[model samples]
Target: MIQKETTGMILRKLRGDRTQEEIAAILGITKSSWAMYERDERVPRDEVKIRIANFFGKTVQELFYTPIEHYKCS
Candidate 1:
């Protein structure tokens, strides 16, 4: 089975060794705002979503909607 990966998890993986402040500045947003997005406490506006996806060289769908495989236990 599979489940959708949380945006926070995906963002963390994409962020790698970069700091939140760095990425946020590159995206022209506040560090705390980016932190909320990565924490899944808030969703970016559509325009911000586009910027984030572009920065990562990913489509918004790919970045925010990729599914993760998981095993179900009986």
Candidate 2:
């Protein structure tokens, strides 16, 4: 089935080699918050989403709504 990529996956990919603390500081968020976001344990508010998207130079839709297909073997 096809599923949208989770925000955490997108964040982690965009973050690359950057430290979570560094990204959190740049985005004006706590490292713990960023960690949670990366773990898919929390969702950021719309404003924070916008900030993250802007920091990554991607639109919210591109970052949060992209779809990926994952097939399971029977």
Give the TM-scores of the predictions, in the order they appear.
0.80, 0.79
Tens-place lDDT per residue, model 1, 10-71, is: 99999999999999999999999999998999999999999999999999998777655678
**lDDT of each structure?**
0.91, 0.90
lDDT of 2 at 22: 98
Candidate 2 Cα misplacement greater than 4 A, ranges? 1-4, 66-74
Q: Which residue pairs collide, candidate 1?
A: none
Top candidate by lDDT: 1
lDDT by residue (tens digit), candidate 2, 20-52: 999999999999999999999998888999999
